[model samples]
Target: MRLVFGLVLIIGVGLAGFAVFMAKDYIGAYQAQLDAERAARANAVPTVEVFVVNRGLRYGEQLTEADIRPVRWPENAIPDGTFRALAEIFPDGEKKFRTVLRAMEKDEALMQVKVTKPGADAGVSSRLSAGMRAFAIKVDVSSGVSGFLRPGDRVDVYWTGRGASELGGGTSGVTKLILPGVQLIAVDQIADSDQSAPTIARTVTVEVTPRQVAALAQAQATGNLSLSLVGAKDDTVSDAVEVDQSEFTGETVAKEKEVCTVRTRRGAEIIETQIACPE
Candidate 1:
């Protein structure tokens, strides 16, 4: 009876030990599965190649592909084809990373001009080739008129001057007339891409042929230049009628009329009255 009891006890302990072993094995499998799930979750986030570089570069600074290195992926990533981010990604170099740009143009002077650099006085993409006529007139476009004005905003030129009144009161007045087909050679003042509350300048320089430049200079010396936004599709220059009325005296019409005076001996007399008008 003792041997029978001992055998039964051994059998019971053996079964308990097997159950504990199985439980441990199951727990190990579960832990391994959890670890794999965490690893996959970590890798699921997409990582892109970003460039980190030093800054404060001149227009023609030499930068190799090695000068720029890949950085940690950022959330609000820059788009694939924008040139604006080049300077932002590579600020003054001490505070943040910068990205340098290479010139596609062969001209050294043109290459040295940092088109991407901001602030007023940045050269317009409307380049001035040697002997090409350009006008040095000021243009005032409301910064609020559009989100921003880049080197390439198409604009229509308008003039505010004294001219014969389109309204026929036999009078003249200061009038704002659309110059019709004048093209914006360049946006004379470009607000810095990195600044707030961009400013307006007295004159925005424009590129014109020699004749146009002459006409523009005359206009600037005499009349006011205004710009109307034409948007992207309307950059074409149409036929324009330009006149020189710089020496306007007042806002009235120039009239020559005959006045009849009945007197004892006089029959009729004609008199001329000059009316100055605004354009």
Candidate 2:
């Protein structure tokens, strides 16, 4: 009976030791998992909900609440003019909808500049600023930059015509820059800025001031106007640019010497005499 009791006590000690070992391993694994989760949380990027288009939208299309969805976006990477909430996008309570000004793809963030005001249509007038007017310029294949221009592009207007010569007497054919860095608001009645396909536009409308409109009207009436595409990211102001046929042919033009003459009027007869030119 004493031997059996000692064996039973020994067995109890062994069982307790085994239980402790199992508990230690389980606790160690749980602690390791908790540490990993904490590290992941610390490294996670902060995000915010932003409205994005659920499907492709084109110019002039109405944007409604059903066409958009909210998604988590990196807070630091959100684009400017992005709508953060449904109320901000639909402030009028769905009585009116905004029109798309530019084309957008699925999941693209809706921007303020990419849409028109509530109940407004996408038109050239919507793109104009205060005190600005829309003027159309005729263009052909050669003058239109081979049909590569779009609505949002900037261009330099070059006029080719006969003008008074710099040397003072006769007229000469000259090409001069009439307008620089003018913003195009529409191409052939299409105000869509996202038009990528090459189109042979017969006319392009530009936004200009009242004074500029007058100048462009005069230049277009008296000369052949051409367009030169400006780079999208270029902000450099163009200097005075005028090129004549003499410059193109690399030929020097000589100014004629001035002749001063004194005339005395006689009855029904006039006599002319050569005199020295004034210094």
Candidate 2 lands at a TM-score of: 0.86
Across residues 1-279, which tens digit of lDDT does each residue of candidate 2 receive?
999999999999999999999999999999999999999999999999999999999999999889999999999899999999888888855545789998899999999999987778899988998899999999999999999999999999999999887755788999999999999999998999988999999999999999999999999999999999999999999999998878768766678788889888899889888899888
Clashes of 2: 0
> How much is 28 displaced in model 2, in angstroms?
1.1
Residue pairs of candidate 2 with colliding backbone atoms: none
- lDDT per model, in order? 0.49, 0.92
What TM-scores do the predictions have?
Answer: 0.39, 0.86
Lowest summed lDDT window (length 10), candidate 2: 88-97
